[model samples]
Target: MTAIAPALVPLLVTLPLLGAAIALIAGRHRRVQITVSVATLTVVCAIAATLLTVVDLGDQAIAVSVGGWPIPFGIVLYVDRLAALLVMVSSVVLLAVLLFSVGQGAVDNDDDTPVSIFHPSYLILAAGIFNAFIAGDLFNLYVGFEILLVASYVLITLGSTESRIRTGVVYIVVSLVSSILFLSAIAVIYGALGTVNIVQISQRMGDLDQDTQLVMHLLLLLAFAIKAAVFPLSFWLPDSYPTAPAPVTAVFAGLLTKVGVYAIIRTETELFLFNDVNVLLMVAAMATMIVGVLGAVAQAELKRILSFTLVSHIGYMLFGLAIATPAAIGATIYYMVHHIVVQTTLFLAVGLVERRAGSTSILRVKGLMKAAPLIAVLYFIPAVNLGGLPPFSGFIGKFALFDAAAEEGDPLMIALIVAGVVTSLLTLYALMRAWNLSFWREEDDSAETEARISYLGDAPAASVSTERRVIPRIMTSATVGMVGLTVALTVFAGPLYDICARIGGALLEPVTIGQLEQEHEQSTGGDDKGEER
Candidate 1:
């Protein structure tokens, strides 16, 4: 089983790329494209699940050197508890969103997302995400980002309407700037250390002067901060995300920024464990939380509100990361997983609300609780979960984070805790307000609704009405499946959090190049022995 596990590492990436090629070729046949994409991600999910189980039960990281090359000279794919869990969770999210998109396309006559182009690009994006999670070298990680950038530009601009096109351009330019910074950092690292292999860099990072180390560190952080949508660097996200198709926005909200967070995790924990940036990061976390939620509060449109909250919640993860303790890191991982699931589910629910109502503007839409109770329930579950209400995964994750921060006993940590709590309350208020306006208020109570809207002064320009569309059962099913998964996060929190705690402990203890090389030899030698037998 161990010997075979090494072989499966590459398939996590290769299968999706192969499926993408097939999906592209079969684009003319919509059914074929759908089958290929779904089957591919389903299989990827199974593989990732197997890997997560293997890595967890074995209690060790798995490393594969591609094409039989030696470690430090080859592209290595590494999966420990963190990477495997993320890949598994990501595959599940990708598959669910794919189904939701399929349903949307079917009902919309493939106008919003043309299956021929969408399927291929979506699979490619999946490949990029999986690759980023498992990447063992800086260069390889950069490649993953580039692949995501290319595929996302295509996905985000589907239908090429003026708004999408404009947003896509902004997304592309921001992404390219970050990529350039990342590439430049890689070059500098390679120049200083003679290699881009992550393990080797960690082993050698201490040899550099403190100033040089700080320079490299800041460059990497700046680049990743932009990707992760950390404050001041997060300006592009709220504007960029809401313009895409529902599936595109959902997946982007759920997975893309998390990839950036993942990179920051690797950078801080693996490469520069002793850095002094925690204070800087904590300040940014506070600002991101306060600023993002404030933006959400001001937005009149549901999508835009979700978009800003998306940015706000990112700060929570950053807060945990800035705390830089094992418990905090564990909480961060749990929160990240929680956010990915809950955020995507919320977006999917909003998509349903949009279909049932004519607009996502709470001012224009009304009485969904009476009109479409299922959509109301669907949106409510994840919305409150995101708002950090108790008994849900959001609350559990936030409590764990706050508990960890309190243990630190630092004033800044306390301030961040206060910011996080305030952010949570505001998130609840904003979402529930939307719910009240869109779902609770009677449609005929226009006078009352308008009276309420008058308090906003000028925020109702985006509240224009449009024709409502029919809601598809598959779309609802997809959302229900995601909501169930979100609930499972709380149901299974004990074991899942045990895993995350173990990952946090393991991540702090960086594996060296020597350890990785020896493991590679042992696995390959065992495979040879099996062949001989």
Candidate 2:
């Protein structure tokens, strides 16, 4: 059982790859596509849970070398508690999206159902995430990123609608460019250390002058900042994500940028463990949050507003990262788990709303209370939760973050706390404003929109539901999935906090980081001695 944890990491990546292949072969077959997708994700979830169990039993991170090569030679895969937890959270949301997609009848005829392409692409993305999470080396991380980007390009451009394409061009260009930057940084890292293994790199970095280390750190950060859609570098996100298909957007909202943040957190702990690097992270966090919410307030569309909020909330995580305390980092990790599920849920719900109401633009769509009561409740719960209202996961996550900041003396950190509160308030206002237009107010129905809508041989779900029930059953289920996650994060704060604490100890102490490097050296030294003998 203990030995299995390391092997399980590769299985997590492989299952998604297998599913993507099946999805590709069965593109026109909705039943096959959905079945393969759901089953693959389900298995991934199980594997992640098991990995978590392994971590609970011991502090040792599961490690395996591909092609029987040790670290710094062949590719290496490893999973600590941090990676396992993220995988678990991701699997849950992926399952929910799969369920919601099935419920929506998004796939019908083999020809009409693009789910074939979606399945393979989605799987590829998941596989990339698994690889990145477990990757023990820099080059391996790059492989993971390329796979994710390739898949994301397809998903973002799925259905190939005019708007999606237009936005996708910007998205594709920005993403590709970011990838190139990341590649360049990796090359530099390789050149600098003569090895691209993360543990080895950390050891090499410690030998370098502070300025050299700073340069490397900054370069790596620039790459992640682009992925994170942090301020100034984030203009491309709000433009592209909202126009993509619902599931694509939902996955993007929940997974893509967060990957960047994960990388930042990992690098910060491994490399820059000494100084208050949280200051830099803090500045970025504050900028990302304030700008994100402001953009949300200005947006007149539903999906777009959510997109801004998605970017904005990234700040809170950064805030915690910036503080660099165990409590702060733990809160950051917890917040990420909460955010991924809730955001995905909200995106799916909004997509359903857009289809039912004939538009995502708030100016064009209206009256959720009158339109779909279940959906109204769905939007309301996440919308308010996103605002970080008490009892919601968002609130719990933020509360942990701010509490950590309170322990610090930096005025900048203090300001981050205040900004976090303000952002939450404004986030609420923007969500509520959109809510007012889309679900509460009445609006004129357009014939063009109606013609594009397929009622599945019946009237729209929105046309029938009364205020008592709110949202449709399918949409309601999707909403429930998201709200349930939010509640779980809120309620499970104790254990979750503990997991985060352990991860922080791992990161801050970097004993694991040290152990991996020393072990690599000892292995190499033994080989040298054997050859000498």
Candidate 3:
């Protein structure tokens, strides 16, 4: 099992890239494109699950050197428990979102997500995400980011609508700026330490002067902070996400920023384990939580409101990172998985709402309770779950995070706990408010609804009503599956969280290049002895 796991690491990335190529070539055959994309992700999902089991049972990480190159010189793909788990969850999300897009395309005749362009780009995006998760070095991670940027640019600008193109431009520019900063940091690190390999860099980072180390740390943090949509760096997200198609929006909200957060976790725990930036991160987390939810409360459109909440919930993850403890880190992982699924489910449900009604504006859409009870139910479950209601995965994750922080008993940790609770309440208010106005009230009561929410003050001007479309069964099925997965996070929280706790503990224990080399030798020597027998 140990021998085989390393070989599977590269396939996690290559299979998706191969599928994207095949999908692109089969442009004229929509069924062929769909089959290849679906099969690829399903297989990747299986591989990730296998790796997760292998790593967990063996209690060792698998690091593969691409092209058989030695450590610190070749491209390395590392699959520890965290990488494997995220890949598996991300693949599940990717597959579900693809099905949702397929249903939308069938119903709308590819008007929103041109099938030929969407399939290949979507697969490429999957490849990028998987690559980033497993990448064992900084340069490889940057390549993953670039791959995401290119594919997402195409996906976001699909249909070439003016609003999409405008948003895509802002997204592209922001992404490019972040990339440049990341690249610059890589250059500085490579120059200083003479290596960009993560384990090797971690081993060497302590050798640098305090000033140099601080500079390098902040550069990488700034780059990833922008990507994770951390406060003061998150302004672009709310404007950029809502303009994309539903599947595009859902996947972007679910997976993209989490990738950034994952990078930050790696940066903080693996690369600069001893860095004293926790205070700075805690302050940022507080601001991110409060400011982001404030933005959400001010929004009248469902998509924009959800986008702001997405940014708000990110602070919870940052708060965990700021705590810099193993338990906090473990809880952050759980919260990340929770937020990804629940947030994506909410967006997909809103997609259904948009199709059922002509608009997503709370003031404009009404009577969904009787008109579309299914959509109402679909929207309500994830809304409250995201709001951090009890027994839901969202609440479980937040409680775990708070419990971890309480162990520290620091004043800032306590303050962040308060901010997090307040943020959760505000998130619920924003989502349920939209729910009540959009679903419970009658169309004839629009005047009353407006009168009641008039304190929000004319923000509905940004919302535009379009012709109502038929809701597709497959889209709803995909969303229902996601919601079920969210519930499963709660039902099976015990075992799954144990795995995350172990991962968190393992993450803080730094591994050196020597350790990887030793493992490589042992595996090769064992294989040779078996061949002789």
Candidate 4:
């Protein structure tokens, strides 16, 4: 079992792609599509969970080389605790979102059903996400990004509606520019190091001049920052995401930017273990937090508001990464897990709100608390949780981050800590404001505005109970399931944090950073000795 564990790693990436092909072939039959998608994700999730347990318990990394080639020569899929844990959590989110989409598709009329293209593209997107999490080399990571981008382009503009087209154009342009920057960085790194393997690059990074190192670092970071939607570079996110379908927006808001954050974590802790740019990263983190929350405050739309807060909360992760201590990095990992679940849940719930209330824009929708109590509960739990209320995963994650930062005990770190607090308070204020307008306040005729609505079958509700019954069981159940996962994060904080702390401690070790390089050299040396014999 132990010897075969590493070989099982590729199944996480391959199963989803296989599922995508089958989903494409079966798209004409909704039942077939649903069955394939759910089964594929369930199996992938199990595989990811098993990988995480094996890696964590074994206290070792799993590296699978394709075509029987040794490290640096063939494509590799590597899974350490961090990568495996991320893949597992991501698979959970992917599964939940897929279920939510299936529910949405089920209730719609034949004419109202989502295009047949959604399933294949959605599964392909899952494959890309899984690939990125386990990618062992820089070039493979780039391939993962490309795969997802192509799928996202289709998902984002599913209807080919005027608004989606306009927004998709902007999104593709921004993504292309970022991709170009990433490709150029890869070229530079390859020119310098002769290999794009992450471990090899980390080992050889020291040999480069300071100027070359900084240039390579900044170029790669610029690309990732755009993808991560870091402030200044992040202006593209709020606009681009809101126009996509609810599930599309939910996954994009929750998972895509974090992939960029994941890259930044890898770059800082693993590749540049000895050399870091904490000051610059801290400044970016501060700005991302403050600016993102303020933007959330200004939005009158639920989706747009969540989108901004999504950007803001990313700063917390950056804060942990910038501190770079074991505790700080550990908190960062925990925070990522919290934020992904909560953010995705909020979006899923809001999607239901749009279905029942006739809009996501707070100015147009009203009285959901009375009209759809279940929907209200769905939104309220995540809303408060996201606002950093006590006894919730969000608060636990934030408190851990603040505690980690305080230990650093520097004035700059202290100031960022204060900013984090303010951001938390303001995030609560913004979410509550939207909640009050959308769910609590009575519908005022004078305040009403044009709403972008995509309600299924039913006309606008005449009473609270009527709207309550309108919600599909599957959609509500999926949202509730995600909310439960968020609760689990708080409930399981001890063991989860221990895992994150172990990962952080390992990342901080210089020897751990060069594990791949050391393995490569030892293997090569052994091969040469055998050849001589």
The digit string of per-residue lDDT tens for model 3 on 1-533 reads 66677778889989999999999999999999999999999999999999999889988787777876666588888888999999999999999999999999999999999999999999999999999999999999999999999999999999999999998999999999999999999999999999999999999999998889899999999999999999999989998898899999999999999999999999999999987599999999999999999999998899999999999999999999998889999999989989989999999999998888988888778899999998899899999999999999899989999999999999989999999999999999999988998888887784665777877656743457778998788999999998888889889989989998998898889998877765555544444333223
Index of the highest-lDDT prediction? 1
- Residue 269, candidate 4: Cα error in Å is 0.9
Q: lDDT for model 3, on a 0 to 1 scale?
A: 0.91
Alpha-carbon RMSD of each model: 2.1, 6.1, 2.2, 4.9
lDDT (10s digit) by residue, model 4, range 156-227: 888787878988988889999999999999999999999888887888999998888999988998999999
Clashes of each: 0, 10, 0, 0
Report the CA-based lDDT of candidate 1 relative to the real structure. 0.91
TM-score of each: 0.98, 0.89, 0.97, 0.92
1-533 per-residue lDDT for model 2 (tens digits): 66556657789898999998988888777788888998999999999999898876676676666765645477877677898898888888878876766655543322212665777888899999888888888778888888988988888887777877898899888878888888888888788888887777776777777787777788888888899899889999988987676667888899988888899888888866763456678888899999999988877677778899999998888888888878888888988888888888789878768767766766656676886787787778888888899888788888888988998868988888899999999999989977876787655666664454323213112232211212246645766777777777777878887888788767776644446634333323434233223
Off by over 4 Å in 2: 105-113, 275-277, 442-475, 512-514, 517-533
Model-by-model lDDT, in order? 0.91, 0.78, 0.91, 0.83
Scored by lDDT, model 2 comes in at 0.78
